[model samples]
Each structure stands twice: as structure tokens, then as C-alpha cells.
Target: MSTLEQTPIGAPGGAAPAGVIHDIGYQRYTGPRLSRRHVVGALYGHSLRTAFGLGRSAKAKIFPWFIVGVVVVVAAALVAIRAQIGQVVLGYAQFADTMSWLVIFFVAVVAPELVSRDLGSGVLPLYFSRPLRIADYPLAKFAALATAVFLLLGAPQVVMFLGGAFTTDAGWSGVWNEFTDLLPGLGYALLWAVVFGGIGLVVAAITGKRAFAAGGIVAVFLMTTPIVGVLSVLPSTTANQLAGLAAPSSLVQGTGIWLFRDALVTNQEGGMGIGDFGPVYALVTVGLIAGCTAVLLARYRKAARQ
Candidate 1:
């Protein structure tokens, strides 16, 4: 019947009773805060895991691991064949050409999952609210993706090298020679990682929808190939050679040929004479990667400002 008792539920025209405050111990974080570098590193590691669908659901993992399994199996088969028949069935450098489509599919699937999910979920503000800078986000994401692509491309080559080493009847010298050959292919894979990863991230960042982003990335890569093909058949060899610049795959293959000093039969057989372009393709490849990276940075910068 006192004042406290008078504050009953649905007490008409009565002021609300004062709320009770419980003293549960809640401590402020006085621990050493991580710097921007650590934040970027953490993000990079996470994005790399995300690329292969690690730490994600089974459905998410199937695509990447499936591609990886296929590559491994093929590399193993090549090695077995070499051991049996005593000849190289697939060269380290040729692996890139053979697996180009799988690489494209991978970048398309992963790039969207990296950037578009962040944008679509409205998490950029949360990311920006941390010690992370605008540029750091893209840098980390690109690094993660590039690293992922490199592993995707490089792991098979390593397997191929080992396969070649053990299978070669020439012994230690053969192993050394195989190692030397892999070096250039490794370099070529690095180029693929950079160029493909950069462009995929840029395209994916443009759309919040993962499907749309994936589709756009695929379309851009696949569409350019046909255009290059058509142009390759032109009467003028110069025009045909120049057309290789239009497609990223051609450009990378062209650069690989120049760097490895080995003619890529795919480029030659496909009528896209990218090797003829020489260092021009390498220069263009670097330019394209640089340009895409610039655009990706600018896009994230704008998002951060907003």
C-alpha cells in the first residue's frame, strides 16, 4: 500500500517507477589495441580463408576444393604417366593454360564473396569504424585474393614438379632441371594472381549482389576471349597480335611466353599470337593490374567517405 506498491501494472495516469540498476561488473577494454597493420593482417588472413571457403559451410567449400582436387588429380595423373611412359605429359608452365577456365571460375566465385558480401551486409561502416584505413581494406582483400589465386595456380605446379622429379630417370640433374623450369611458371602464376585478382575484386566491389558481381566478372573475361579470337583471324598479323591485349588470359599467356622463353602452344594454336607481342603484353598486363587496383582503391575510398 506504500508508494512502491502503488506503481502497479496499467496504473492509469501514474508516473513510471524509477528503474532499478544492477551493478554487474562490466570492464572497459584497457588492453593494448591492435595497430592498423595487425587489423589489415587479420583481415587478409580471413579473406584468404574465405577464398577457399575455409571456416565456412560445406556448400561454400565445394567449389574451391573441387577445383583444387581436380587440379591435383590431373597433376598426379601427369606425374604417373611421365613415370610410366618416361616423358613429360604436362609442363609446369602449361598447367596455367590448361587450368585457365578453373582459375577464372574461382576468382569469380571468390571475389564477390569477399567484397560484395561486405557491401551488401552494410558492414563497411563497422570496418571503417576500426583502426583500418580506406586503402587497407582493398589492399588486404586484394592480397588475400591474390595469394589465394597464386596457391590455386601454384600448388598444382608444385605437385607436377615433384611428380616430374621422382618420375625422371635422369636422377638429380633431372630434379634440378625440373626445379629450374618451375621457377618461371611460379612467376607466371604470380602474374595471374595479381591481374586476375585485381580485376575480379574491382568488378565485385561494384555490385552488392554476389550473383551479379560473379556474372559480371565471368562475362568480362569470357567475352573478351571471343573478341580476341575474332580479331586474331584478321588478315593483318599486327592486328591479330594486338588483339591479344584485349583479353586478360591472352595477355597473361603472352607475358608468360616472353618471360619463360617458351612458346605457349595454346596461344599459337588458338590463332591468338600473343607471344608475337613480346614485352608489350607484359607491360599491358602490369598496366591493367595497376589500373584495376587503382579503381578498387578509389571505390573503397568513396565508400569510406560516405
Candidate 2:
């Protein structure tokens, strides 16, 4: 009658075969794709909340200002006691160099916490069960740490640059010049952040324990720099980016200094600045970043299944 009279399957009675419930159950179990956008949004919100909470903490609020006050008091005392204090203050213009410390420490220590905690605590599995995907986790974590580092480390350089421009003999035009000059330096810093952040992520994913991951990252990074720094001095072979073992900051800073030196040498051998470093450093920095990202992703694929 109605298609209910199906074709026979080994019988004259022309009956339709029953569907398997196990197949239906299996179909129901298929998971959803992890959404990158969702992960990013969630991580962004989380980071903001954490930052805000830290800002509200009484100890945190007092600690920073206390350090600033101590530095200012010391500077004032130095100025009153010694004429060289003025020179020292002027040399403070090179303060941006100190940002490398925070960049290195934050990348090696803080990034791993953001990455490994969720996975180690089983939160990642719950997140994966939702609309969020596994791939999104690392991307979101990377974005969060990069942004946090920028805000924490880069923002100070920006403020100092502006402060120096306005408060010092450097006028509006000088300020603009300095700002333009900083573009390359900031670009290198950003690339280093990404490279190190990726290394932290890979270490976290593989290690699973936050403390071990963080400590191992810091130790390895610290150990590598000195070794590379010594090796860089060897005759007949200047340390290229490869021997650095993915050390982006050292490579960028070193290369940037070299570019500045080249610029100065070409122009009456003036004092070398960051501008001496050429585009080659920038290119190599980008390559390191991309390479770290690729390794992180490949390692993540394995981590996900585990």
C-alpha cells in the first residue's frame, strides 16, 4: 500500500527491516566542533576579570605604589647628594630595556598557569563537551597571555616614551620621531612574546602539572640564554637565530642592536641605537614565532587525544 509495503529481504512477505538503536545512539554521541570565537571570548572575559580582581586586592594595590615611592625617594636623595644623579636620571630613558625581564619571566612562568590549570583540573574536558573546541583552548590562552603581557609590559614603555617626549627637551616633533622609532622595537617585543608564550603552552600541555611546567620553562629559558650568549662570542661564527634555540627576545634585541649599529656606522659611526638592527632580525623573529606556533599546535593535537 503506502511505501510500508517495502521490498522483501530474503522472504516473500516484503517487510522493511528495523533500524538499529545502537547506530542511533552512536549518531547522538557525535560531538560538536570547538568554536574558536567562543573560546577567545571566554578567555578574554576571564582575563579581564582576573586583572580586575588583582587590581582590587589590597596587597596588590599597595605593593606597586610602595615600590614606586621607594624608587622616587632614592632618586631624590641621590639628586640631593650627587651631581651624577642628573645623568643617571637621563640614562633612565633607556628604561625600556628592563621590560625584557618581565617579558621573559611572564612568558615562562605565568603563561603556563593559564594553560595547564584547566587541563590538569579536568575543566578542559567539560569545556570541550560544550560548543568550545580543543583547538580553541591554546589559541585563546595564547591571546590572553599576549594581551596581558602587552598591557603589563608594553604599556609602561608607551607611557614612559610619552612622558619623556612631553616633560623633557624633546618637543612634539621629537616625540613623534621617538614614537616612530619605537615601532620596530615594539614589533620585535611582540614577536618574542608570542614565541615564548607558545613555548610555555607546549610545556604546559605536555607536563600537565602547573608548577613543574612553569619552573621547567623558566629554568630552560634562563639556562639557554647564557649558553647562547657565550656561544655568540665564538670567532668565525656569529650566533644566528638558529643557535639561539628559539630565544626570540635575545635574537630580536641583539639583531635590533646590530641594525642600529649598522645604521650608525654607515652614518659617521654614530652611537648605535635600536634602529641599527635590520629587517633580517624582524624576519627571523617572525619565523621563530611561526615555528613555535606550529610546534605548539602539533603538540596540542597529541595532547588533546591524551
Candidate 3:
């Protein structure tokens, strides 16, 4: 009041007066910054944990573990049958094909959890603000989802292998054969992981709403099946031969028939009619994985910019 009374300030047409400044004593962080690789590794680990709901709420744990339980229970029953009856109802390669629906459901449920929430909460910008490049985030998510799928499919195959090995009358020779078969089975599971993970992540990354993302993923897999049936019934032999390309499940089955005919097909009559276009199936399968991956990268690129 004394200063104001002593001098009148800011009359009309007068210039503005400067305000006082004060230092709050905040320190600058000059510490060593972690590189991009560390950021990516951490993100991958976090995403992988998210896939199985490791640190998530109990409600979040239910669906993934339910799918896992069903798959395991089925595998255990098959192992029991192999031990007791000495007859393999389904071979190693067939196990993946048999579990295709469950794999789809798992991907539908988990992929959205991995990505959509980040999108919904608008945390991607914060993620990009770190040492991570645009590509690192999407690739980390893709790798985590793929590893999770592999574990889901691979664990039960191990159980089946152990059951077969321990129960075989052929002794060590049987164990070796079981080992050999398990390798192809795991490889087939890897293929499943790639196809589903790539496709699912790309779809999930497109939207911020988890429900929409999940529905779109389900539709992507399920809606294509009828097209395959229609193509299979077509009059053209070429259409029938290439019909499996229409759906992801049939596409993987066709690829399996091409690569692991002995494990997937019991007879010429029982197998997919991929015909001489086996190479086509192989090429298309690779294309699906590669194409989905490219799209995933592009998706995040656009997201990062915005």
C-alpha cells in the first residue's frame, strides 16, 4: 500500500511493468539416459506380462487362463489316451489345427489388452516421448504377443511329448522319435504364433476401443470362413485347390499340408487339396505375416505423428 500510494503505475497508454522473478531451485537431470534398446526391452517385458494378465486385476486373468486351461486339459486328455490306448488320435501338427479356434479366441482377447488400452488412454504419445522410436513400440508389442502365443501352444506340446516318451515300449528309440516329432510341432506352433500375432496386433492397433478391436479381430477370422467354403464348392479346379487361402485357419492348415504333410495328413483323401500349388500356400503365408507386420509399422508411424 505504501509503494502503490508513492507511485501511480500503468496509466492509460503506458507500457506494461515487469514482474519479479524467483528461482524455485529445481535441478536439471544430467544423469545417464538409457538407450533405445533398454526401453524396447522393458516395453516387451511389460507387454508380455500384460498378455497373460500377470500384474492385472483378477477379472483380467480369467479369460486368458480359461483358454489356457481348456487347451491344457484337452492336451492332458490326449496324453492320457496315448498312454492308455497306445493310439494317437491326433498327431503333433494336428494339435495346432485342432486348437485353431482357441488360438483365435485367445488372440482376440489378448491383442486388445496389449494395445487398445494404451491407445484409449492416449499413452502412446507418452511412450513416444521416451527413448523409443516409432517402430520400437509396435515391434515390441508384436514380439511379446508372438512369444505369448508360442508359450500357450508350446507348453502343451511338451506335455504330450513327455507322455509319449515315458509310455512308449520302444524305450530310448521312442523318446528320440518323440523328440523329432515335437520339433515339427513346435515349429508349426511358431507359424501359428506369427500368423495370428501379426494379424491380431495390426487389427488391435487400429482403434482405441477394446470392444471394437476385439469384434473386428473376431470378424476378420470368422467372416472369411464362409468364403473358403464357397470357393471350395466352385466349379474351377484351381479355385478348389487354392480355397484354403480364404481363412487364416485354413491358410495355416494348407501351409502345414505343404510343409508337414506326413504329420498333418493321414491319407491323400483326408488332406487339404492344395495340389501343385503348395508353393503358393507357402508364399501366401509368408506374405500374410510380412504384410501384417508392415501395416503394423505404418499404423504406429501415423499414430506417432498425430
List the candidates' TM-scores in order.
Answer: 0.90, 0.64, 0.88
> What are the root-mean-square deviations of the candidates from the true structure over C-alphas?
4.7, 9.9, 5.3
- How would you encode candidate 1's per-residue C-alpha lDDT over 89-184 as one tens digit per residue? 667778878888899999999999999978877678789876888888999999999999999889989998888887677889989999998997
Worst 10 residues of 3 by lDDT: 1-10
**What is the C-alpha lDDT profile of model 2 across 1-306, one tens digit per residue?**
123323445655645554322322223555775565756697766754443235356753453344334434543443343343322242221333344555565555565556676666755566665566666666777776666555554544454455445544457787686576556445544544566666666677677787788788777567777776665555624343334433554565545455443222332222222333356566776676677677666666665676
- Candidate 3 residue spans exceeding 4 A from truth: 1-33
- Cα deviation at 280, candidate 2, in Å, is 6.0
Could you arrange the candidates by lDDT from highest to lowest? 3, 1, 2
Tens-place lDDT digits, model 3, residues 1-306: 122222236544554534434455667999998899999999999999998989989998999999889889989999998878889877777788788888998999999999888777767888998678888998999999999999899998998998899999998998999999998889889999999999999899986588988998999999999999999999999999999999998888888788887777663257469899889999999999989989998988888777
TM-score of 3: 0.88
Model 2 bad stretches (over 4 Å): 1-39, 48-96, 168-171, 237-248, 258-284
**What are the lDDT figures for the candidates, one per model?**
0.84, 0.54, 0.87
